[model samples]
Target chain A: MRLLYFAWVREKTGISSEEIDLPAHIETVGDLLRWQKTRGEEFAAAFEKDRVIRAAIDQTHARHDAAIAGAREIAFFPPVTGG
Target chain B: MIRIQEGDFDLSAEIEALKDSRTDIGAIVTFTGTVRDRGSDKVIESMTLEHYPGMTEKELARIEQEAHARWPLQASLIIHRVGKLLPGDNIVLVATASAHRHAAFEAAAFLMDYLKTDAPFWKFEEGPDGAGWVDARETDGAAKARWSAKSSSKEEPAST
Candidate 1:
């Protein structure tokens, strides 16, 4: 799956976007976040404070428990206040 | 009917393009959004807008189509400027033409309301204080919800 980060999210994570191999167990968004946390220090720091992070699956707003099967892209960002 | 460009556009040229010899165009409604000096009273020095290339165009087109379905429109245009912009620079333009003033006004307003909320553009403003990325506002979400809910209700026939 492809993972995308924006705004302060990219700053914290230290990457804009990356293609990652998802584990079979990472079937939900929550599972994906948990899996990402184990990747490295940056991932741990980025995901450690989930209060400010928001996720969207395939461009539409998504929740943590949303299914992630066959998702081509998942984007993480801070709460958007763009006009 | 929808354009996302980095170059500035002449409003007259756009309006002329939508006009013809036919006297049907009785009204032309337009909304121009400009960068304010401040976002929440922060003195913004400059701002840079970023967007997903393909997805941005797709989303704008969809919003335009939705407005057309709701109102009887003769012509419609949505223009958005991306990249670095300063205060007073035009950020967006939404114009609607119709035979009646009501349709033109309603469609133009509808376009802007949705564009503000639904468009996938990110703005990073650099101010005297510091640089910060603008977040999505709850008011914008409310604006989008109004149209979406109206669209959904219209989908179902009114119960007699």
Candidate 2:
């Protein structure tokens, strides 16, 4: 699976995207956020405010409990500020 | 039509294209969002607009389709610019056309409201003081929520 970070989340994570093989336990967006924090200090800081950070599965906006099974791409970002 | 590009768009040409020789269209409403020089604290010199490559277009198209389904619109267009932009530069444009003024006006507003919250775009402001990401406004969320109620009355076709 591919993970993308945007805005402050990107800044904190220090990389825009990465390809990772998720462990069996990471099945939901919330689960992925929790597991990513344990990867490194940068990821820990990026997901510090887990609720504030938004997640998208397969480029669609998703809630914390959204399933990530078979998703090709997942993105994390702050609330959108576009107009 | 939905366009996401780094280059600025011509409002007049876009409106003309939306019209496309259709004489039945009675009203056309447009909203343009521009880069502001002043932020909450600093005088912003430039702003950088970032967006997801594939997702941005998809989201915009989805909202545009929703607007069309809700309103009796003759045509609609959305253009959003990304990358570095100076103050006063155009950031986004939404134009809606219908047989009556109310539908055009309401659909344009609806599109703008959805774009603010649902679009996969972020704004970063830079000035002499410093640079920071623009925070999402609660008011924007409120604006989008107004359309959640299934108000069939608002979707009435234009008689004029």
| lDDT leader | 2
Q: Against the true structure, what is model 1's DockQ?
A: 0.28
The CA lDDT at B23 in model 1 is: 81
lDDT of 1 by residue, A1-83 (tens): 78998776787799989998887887887788787788799888888866556676777656777898878989876654434
Could you give candidate 1's per-residue lDDT for residues B60-119 as a string of tens digits? 787789888989998899999889999998888899998899999988878877776556
Which 10 consecutive residues of model 1 chain B have the lowest summed lDDT?
B151-160
lDDT of 2 by residue, B95-147 (tens): 99999999999999999988888898999998999999998887887787789
The worst-scoring run of ten residues by lDDT in candidate 2 chain A lies at A50-59
Which DockQ-derived CAPRI band holds candidate 1? acceptable
Where in model 2 is the C-alpha error above 4 Å? B149-160
Error of 2 at A52 (Å): 0.4
TM-scores for chain A over all candidates: 0.91, 0.97
Candidate 2 Cα deviation (angstroms), residue A43: 0.8
